[model samples]
Target chain A: MAPQGPRRGPVRDGAGRAGRPRPGSRRCAVTQRLAPRWLEAETFDCRDAFVETLVALASEDPRIVGVVNDSVGSSKLDAFRTAFPDRLVNVGIAEQDMVGMAAGLAGGGRIPFVSGAACFLTARAMEQIKVDAAYSRNNLKLCGMSPGVAYGELGPTHHSIEDVAWLRALDQLVVVVPADPVETAAAIRWAAAYEGPVFVRVSRTPVPQVHPADHTFTPGRATVLHEGDDVTLVSNGTVLWRALAAAEQLAAEGIGARVLSMASVSPLDTAAVVQAARETGALVTAEESVPRGGLGGAVAEAVVAHHPVPVRMLGVDAFAPTGSAGYLLDRYGMSPEGIARAARELLHRRRS
Target chain B: MPSTLSHAHLTLTRAPRPPAGAPRDEVVAQLRETARQIRLQDLALVHFAGAGHIGGDFSAVDVLTVLYGAVLDVAPDRVDDPERDRFVLSKGHVAGSYYVTLAAYGFLPVEQLATFLKPLSTLGGHPNRLHVPGVEASTGPLGHGLPIAVGQALAARLDSSPRQTYVLTGDGEMQEGSNWEAMMSASHYGLDNLTVVVDRNGLQQGASTEASMDLAPLADKARAFGFAVSEVDGHDHGALLDLLGSRERPGGRPRFVIAHTHKGHPISFMSDQVAWHHKVPDADQYATARAELDALAPAAGGAL
Candidate 1:
């Protein structure tokens, strides 16, 4: 089955001109046609991106390794295992031990990317992440595959919406939520090169390419995808494409909305946030995570600390009901229309 | 039976003066003096900081002294050398004592001790690798160091390096499930390069280890988890050094040393008492404790 369009490309170049198709562009065609109306071609299922990135990175760096907790299939690493048999270490279903083992491998001079379902990786082995990677200052990359409402139909137990919030609270950890495949690949390359601890969230839901291929991802910098003078739409992870589409829709209504791809949630780009607040007047932050401590809360924290501005946060307020990721995102008011409505409301508040 | 006794005596007499050709007497004496100085520094830092687990510091000071003064293959200038042995103080709340020991052994400057726990000082309440020199990892939360040490040991094994990895944990910290998880993995991987020393002071924050959580028959548990268990008097520098220096048991398994000790070892009033666990000694108590430690002369020993 071909992935849908709009989510993938013939992606728009930095100059906004539609260009040649990238290698993974075909997958998005299937998602675009099969996905619900609100989701576009740019939105991508993260499982595919994770496996693809891992396989590519392993080919480039022999020392690159994968540590999973019986999540080989769930984390979409079958191809990775087939490609590099000895590189993928499956430590059964023990999350804590899996993380510890990754730390051990890192100590042995291997760059270990620990991939697991977010809920277990963040909650079950939180202590190990805190001590082994963060505290020990080991060069470990923790890849949380299928995070946020990506597992929406499986119910709240499997949902990883709280991962960003929980991980961001820890000191000395770099928290990243890549906006799309381009950003995901960029984040992976940066994480491999960057020393020390990092938490990268890979979504199961599809998202459009919000940034250009040349987009350089700095640890604490937010990328402004579109420039406008009205309300700013800030988001990360799977919700970023929705924010961008919402910005497009808002532009039609004569509202000049700026869309920002907030890839790094921790050590947040405070200057960008403050500038967005001052220049844009109002802001609407969206994410597939909770409205608390995720992107919304982080932006709010930065804004309030330095630049106070009217802001509306859009996310899952409570545990999502059993439904597809699309249904849950729409039901929770994270669809393009919902985000556009939020931007309008925030603009109204700013005027009032 | 008589022949066995004679053989044992002959082995004891020919023990080769502590490994690495160090004279046993001199090593013991230097370690003892180092222990006293560490204790004094611990007391001073705790008093100045107004916060420290003093009792636990006292309990584990001898172990730190021996490791820094003799057993471990580490030095200040060559601290980051990958082939050098690694020491992780898992019981991080007693960071004051660890810092003092590091300073005395030239891993860090003794003058830095004065800035401990003060604002902007690298010597935090816990050992943070980013701030403190020679501190391998940040460890205040219990049960964390062993896993990292296990990783470092595994790293050494992979590289075919002879360097060993040692981690010191509080007996109470064993309650955390992560420790057992690491232990199982360590043994499964046959990490003979790893050594875990539990400061079995028998007391925790609220009460005794027995009252808090019974870890009695701790050695049996370690054995079951595929470790060579060594029960030693934690405060006895010679005993700690000897056990830490010996080769692993016949099987290539991780080693666990349960160092039995008092919460406050030497001070008459503080020893074995839980109240002094983190309580700073007042003027009178401080003077008495100082005099007690000062009266004991340094034992004689050669370098490891």
Candidate 2:
């Protein structure tokens, strides 16, 4: 049931472009329809997309350098090192130095992409991220690889579920989590061209290409995958693919659920969130990370202040038990069926 | 006075540079007088602001004086040069001395010293590179600057630039694990253009560093970290100049000069006293300390 949007205006003058999808208008074509029959075969890892794009960008821009903390193989930077031997600086297993030296390299008029494991890169070097990159407003791209439980049974110590929450609170930082290979490559090109601090997830987890080959990624914006009114589902990174799948399942059940794929976490698309609250009357956010903060927290804040709506967040809330990547996704109720079930439950809360 | 995001309005009273090789003895005497003046100014700023780390500031000021005056290819005009020498103040709690030394080098106006710690004054407790011309990094956090200096050294090599990078850290500051981490790659990269000077001021914040964490036998420690280690009386200008000469010894890893000094040196009462660490002196102590420094200093020819 598509309810009339609430009349309440924005809390701040710049809540960004209203999150509500205009009548029959779509920002991203990928959101307009389901996956075509021809697009069923090969999948691409976002990390591979990131390295290919980075190498291409580095060739034209002399300033681009890759700074890694002994994760050349994990981050897929061996090719980068071979291409630009002097440009790749392996700081030898020091995450703190990896980040700090990236800031220093920026200070010396070079653009450095500091890459490593998401867990160690974000948590181990948070202070450097805060002071050197964010507070000091240095131009450095922090590429976090194999985020979420992408490490599978490598355990909680390797889990980067807290990165979104930790980084989104910092000032002058842009946080983006691309859904698939096309968007991942697009996001890398954007981060490198854009000056100032940017944190992007270069995930090793493979997923079907969500965006078309030419589709571009924009910061502080959301791509409306499907426009519906019964409820809204929001997600990004690997979970966005599941979110889209969830919408398709809900559509089959005659529950018209809208789906929004958010790339930017810090400069969150409040307008779209407000629109989701007003039009859908309920919202369900699913991220691969923690239940709090992440995309859910950003959406909830918008919903509560501007247009109050019933919201249910889907993600791992506690320390995840040992399991493979696929098992963890299904175990934590992050599969398409589970997400669709959450959306139906939220719609119940809305209709009642 | 609001310190609101603008360049310092005050002008330099005099160009704070030495004449071309005046005489070895004269330059030493001028530098000694300059060092003494910097000490008194540091004390005054601390007294004015009612806050400072005067102990390490005093311990490090002489090392800063000799470097700014005799060493370092940086001048206010050449600050934009790609090949200019880079100096990072790793012991950044001593902003009073660093600021005063910057002033003495004409990098900042001598009058800007009055804004020390005042609200909105760019003269913050720590040096911010964005706020000052000569400041290479925004540092207050202890272990950060050494690593930044290592990156700069690496950058110089990448650029094939002849500029040398020098970083000054406290002996107590060496306890920060990041310092050792930076030192490992510094030699691994074979950075002969890098020289790290340890202001071996025996005091840390609360107690003597020997009692606090005991970074004793500091020279052996540097040599072990792949440095061509040297030791000098930190207060002696001539000996320091000799050690800091501009030369890259072929296959020499990196130079680590441990300039032995006492916290609050030359101030008889405050000397070696841990209480002087960030403690602003009272009027009587200030007057006595100034008098002691003034007796040795000649007419403050160069005061930042």
Candidate 3:
């Protein structure tokens, strides 16, 4: 059977782009339109965004609860616990038990948002996510905190570069990676209201807002951050800002590039991908995760299926060396300069 | 002691079925009829599907019949009620028995029994909660149901709801690490609202649990896990009901019942045979087994 509610048309922007249309565009249609509208100087971290949004949601609905694995301090949920002490369930350091307990809580009529380090939450509790949450169709919202190389210098064991790839392999799971605090808040609200299982990566690293304050968040839809026609630079998570910067650099070199913030990686926006292939002729995908089975792989799969176009995938190929998050990104060729160079090379190859 | 008083006290204290308000003889007769029908349905389903863990199904059929027939406070009408007690068939490969038990108890229609393991039937090889009405969880990979049951038990305690949670796992399935993890959590939480029934059928897929990974002194191990341990004949309906309904310990520790059972109970050729784990019965053997089960009238006393 089809999904429960009225089906939405394929999300497209004013210029007939992939995401919600621009302010005045006729394709900017949605059921609920209360998008985030934050000021430029209104700086907020993702942790702050998570706590503020959760507390507000809890106040409105008593069923909202937080399930953690003794990472309350790391997840910045101490304030949330103080506000709703009984609502926060800490299941010690056992990740499997934590996810299973969340499923149980959801079974008992509670909407549990399970938070923990992304590395363990995705790998350790993968079976639970597949069986209990997705297979059983439980209404559990999994918030993977501090994903990617945010735990830089701690080595590969601490980094969560495989979370996206791992979670993307599971069917019936909505994989989302919000670019900034506004997107994070919007994604959280969307998850609470959505009636299915969702896995959202909450980055610890800071990033500037790339979406408009009234930017709407929808599962399986891509957002066009900057409009260009020469080539498309697609990315999500912290790497989205880097992709936008790369697009600007490409524009400086007189190479117009379309930037797409690909938040939902599983049910990828194939129409936008095909449009980019037909209009732009080349594609470049960037992410703070492994290129294998992640955004790059997802995009490649879509391109090969319907539209075959030259594509450049940017991500860490091997276990990261010890360094800061920025240093690691630059070292792994994830910086704006690195991405721009890669896009330029792809465009050159396309001409040749 | 009269069986009436014994069954009455069992219902009064720990039985999950509707109270034994009916006449004692009537209750006994109902239990007998339910058990027989469940066996017949289970045998027919396994023969029709051409694939089933028939040995385990036959071994656990009596316990399931007793629970649904006269022990659980659940009915077809109240299946989705939050207050109804929950049963998780952890050993889900024996789904033929569970399907038949649920069907006989009116959780589903009897005609649906023919559709077991069909392409579009909800009766899959394993119990899937999304498809099955009374299944609490989808369990095929072992050791999953215990933790979920623990979670439900903890939820019951938190909500101050009197609904109890019961999970039945094969003796061999306990070797998974997840079961130990759940056991630790269940004890740590002091969940007296949960009962774990271990179908000690001895044989696993390849060999007996003892020969493969010995769980000898199983009762002591449960006690070490902070549970009130009880050992009984799994095929005896009265013994199974009484043991399943025992009171919790003073400290609110969880309960564990190690039910000693043959792999294929009441079947002369299949009982206690290791190869019968999932072996389908042939025509000749099937006829003999059906005759044996059909001849099994209600035991004169609690001696079955």
In model 1, the runs with Cα more than 4 Å from the true position are: A1-43, A59-63, A82-110, A127-132, A135-137, A208-210, A303-309, A346-352, B1-19, B47-50, B298-304
Which sections of candidate 3 miss by over 4 Å? A1-44, B1-19, B23-29, B246-251, B299-304
List, in the given order, the native-contact fraction of each candidate. Answer: 0.54, 0.39, 0.42
- Tens-place lDDT per residue, model 1, A1-352, is 1222234442222111223444544224223323243332344555676677778888998778888888988877899999987677666677877777677677667788999999999999998898878877789999998888777667999888888888898898999998777777778878998988899987666566567767766999888888898989998887777777778888889999998888999989889989999998788999888879888899999889888988899988788878666667767777777888888887777677
**What TM-score against the true fold does each predicted structure earn?**
0.85, 0.89, 0.88
What TM-score describes the B chain of model 2?
Answer: 0.92
How well is each residue in A1-352 modelled by candidate 2, as lDDT tens digits?
Answer: 1111212321100012223334543222222233442124345566777888888899999899999999999998987988999899998999888888787778777899999999999998898898788877888999999888888777888888899988988989999988888888888999999999999997766566666677787888888988899899988988887788778878888988898989888799899999888887889998878868877888888889999988998876667888655457666777777788788877776567
RMSD of each: 9.0, 8.9, 10.2
Model 2 CA lDDT for position B265? 86
Report the lDDT tens digits of candidate 3 across residue range B134-199: 888888888777877887777777778888888899999999777777777888888888888999
Candidate 2 vs candidate 3: which has greater lDDT? 2
Q: List, residue by residue over B1-304, the lDDT tens digit for candidate 1.
A: 2211121211001011234666887778767766876786677677656688899999998898888777788778877777778888889999878888887777666667777777898888888876777787678887777877877776676668888889999999999888887888788778888989999999998899999999988999999999989899888878887888675454698999999999888888999998988898776787788677767744422122
User: Taking the tens digit of each residue's C-alpha lDDT, what string does model 3 give over A42-71?
Assistant: 223466677778888888988888988889
TM-score of chain B of each: 0.90, 0.92, 0.89
The 0-to-1 C-alpha lDDT of every candidate, in the order given, reads: 0.78, 0.80, 0.77
Give the lowest summed-lDDT range of ten residues in model 3 chain A.
Answer: A30-39
Instruction: Tell me, by lDDT, which candidate is best.
Output: 2
Q: Between prediction 1 and prediction 2, which has the larger lDDT?
A: 2
